[model samples]
Target: MGLSSRPRCQLAEQYGPVFTVHLGGQKTVVLTGYQAVREALVGTGQRLADRPPIPIFQLIQGGRGIFFSSGPRWRAARQHAVRTLHGLGVGRAPVADKVLQELRCLVGQLDQFGGRPFPLALLGWAPANITFTLLFGRRFDYQDPLFRSLLGLIDDVMVLLGTPGLQLFNLYPRLGALLRLHRPVLRKIEEVRAILRALLEARPAPAPGGGPVHSYADALRQHGQGGDPDGLFSEENVVACVLDMVMAGTETTAATLQWAVLLMGRHPGVQDRVQEELDRVLGPGRPPRPEDQQALPYTNAVLHEVHRSITLLPHAPRCTAGSTRLGGYLLPEGTPVLPLLSSVLLDKTQWETPGQFNPGHFLDADGRFVQREAFLPFSAGRRVCPGARLAQTELFLLFAGLLQSFRLQPPPGLGPAGLRTVPAPAFTMRPPAQVLCAVPRPRGR
Candidate 1:
């Protein structure tokens, strides 16, 4: 289970910084505490960079994408993913425009609830569609059946990724495959791939005049057609990479937004402070922009705190590229290393209040928003999340836009206490099912 690692870190404090934990009969080295995690993942990143093979992910299109593959294959796929996104304006005004556009539609949809309780289940849809637009040159309507199904499948896949069956499959790949325990997961993967294939097929050939590289699929196709002797970016790899973009990008960002809403509702005082900052920084009728992040210090702090409070993935699995020493221990080549990121997020020495939801962790004495080195919600090192900037932008725009436009509150009859947040175990730590009321704020308040 991907629960808090503080207890394990406490054990580490007693035993040692680096200790071995038994997982599915495999001895995995666990690095706890900020100094240990940072030293191994950041200091000797490349040495500890290779991804440990998981049977489930290895079955993900034969492990062709950036997230699963290692060595030259991973390098080429990652380079393509990064370069393609950068070419598509991932960290710039173009991507922000896409996010803002979707956010506007999302706000409008929430307005129809009329301050009534609404499930934030499909909160990931807009961002998923934003990613869809980036990958396939199209966006799905909020109520599109296909779009909803895709999101549902993605959510199910995340749930499956953390199951005991998956763990057993990871440990004994052949036996799990023989038992067909991975069949359900494989079916879902096929469904996701089918969607990607449809979108790829829908793409028209590049114009004879060759104006501009349109979408991610097109960019990938153009690259593949350029005749690579290495065959790094093959057609199958293109689909897998698209799947990676959608899978890697969607739930994490969506879960962050969901946590933001829940936290805002749970702590109305903090929410108000953020709204106050939003109003003071950018007044009525204007949606908050990425540039506004600097001016809106309290809001920025709250966003950072939300990520800190709800550290998503408890740990990231890393493998030693070669024999190397980490945390004062000699790890042999191909040794599996689990960097306890949750420990770092809630490290006692680094954070003033490691257990509480305090935005002050990222706030300076003068109320300026300051970045904390311990904020490793995205994890770090050579294999750090490739979509960090895009995720941050989505988080900022969605968080700021919603707070600016509405006063988020718990469902009627459910106070903060009634709205208890239990962690839903998945590929990430998902928030419990709760309803939030987006009470539209009066204009010019």
Candidate 2:
């Protein structure tokens, strides 16, 4: 929740890759850089993949959801979610189509400003709607009050969870409860739960052929039928699982794209390079397709650079399972772990320009898109983000579509040097509130 240049970086410099830190009297192991984090998380993921219990999250999710929950329940819910998303065409054309549909709406919405200053606040709704379509088999209109309220609640929870007060609450649950410090977050969680409950109730049951309508909810209903008398697919877990996916997917992606647009608008030279690639690979009047990503390497590189530069999650939360030795230290069982992804992204040894927005980190000399091992935005190991592919596809298509349709510009008299890119402190690091103009590209070169 601190600024992007995590204080942990200084700690790593002083204490080496794996050092012990005391947070609220809890002894936790911090893993920094690419090598140490990969070795601990990927090499020994089984022993280090568990989640430490946070009092606030324990109260909010009750350890029922896939995220923040470990052991059999987390395993079952995660497996089912992956299988169900694949069954519903998450990694394929259907999801791409849904993303493109939403992108068009977003582009159209941007056009209404007519080159005037527009804040990218509502930009999150587009990706949120994609999750809505995937989970409940429906999309919310941009102007829908219910949709706005739902997003607002999600925003409130994200912001509240990252506050220092929440940390104090987690440290002393009884005292914080007496003080009502976590009441706002608790209220927001309940509101979201209620919304999920209503959506689940209204969802149509699975058909004989197991059709796509209400695919996720239907699959959860079916999966719950054959499990143990009480299992992860219970009505409660269903809502929690959906909430996990929605919360996990929506804001991170929306923030990523928001940064994408901000960086592009700020860096017009890079934006021009991306537009050149888009125009060369995709002819005039042609809609950008997912397949075009390979041909438009610079565009893809820009997106990857944005992911790296933004440093979305400073550190991913993880914990140890059994006693294990890592980084030449014997970590006791249940040791909390914070794999500093920000450290990895900005590792001086890994990237030539860690702080700057340079797409070359992901591009080869031949100008082709290349993936670096140090790039762990979705994290690594067995607990890596399950929706990585889905997120990538949506990001590429939406980014290309936007660049194809519009030439992003900063506000009048504000150039790249004047544009501020540092993100505000939150659950997810998001670009600061700012205005930009999405000037439409003129017809044909």
- Local error of candidate 1 at 280, Å? 1.1
Compose the digit string of candidate 1's lDDT tens values, residues 141-176: 998888888998999999898787777788877888
| Candidate 2 per-residue lDDT over residues 1-445, each given as its tens digit | 2222367889889989988777766877888998998898789868887888988889888898888899888888888888988988887888888998998898889889887888877677788888888888899889998899899898888888878788788777787899999899988899988888888888766664444455677788777666456577788888888889889888888889889988888889999899888888787877777777788889989999999988887776788889988998888889888888989999999999998889999999999999899999989888988888888888888888888888888899888778787677578888888888888886421
- Please list all clashing residue pairs in model 2, or write none if there are none: none
Could you tell me every candidate's TM-score relative to the true structure? Answer: 0.96, 0.96
lDDT for residue 317 in candidate 2, whole number 0-100: 77
Q: Provide the lowest-lDDT 10-residue window in model 1.
A: 1-10
Clashes of 2: 0
Q: Which lDDT values do the candidates have, in the order given?
A: 0.83, 0.84
Which stretches of candidate 1 lie above 4 Å from their native place?
Answer: 1-7, 207-211
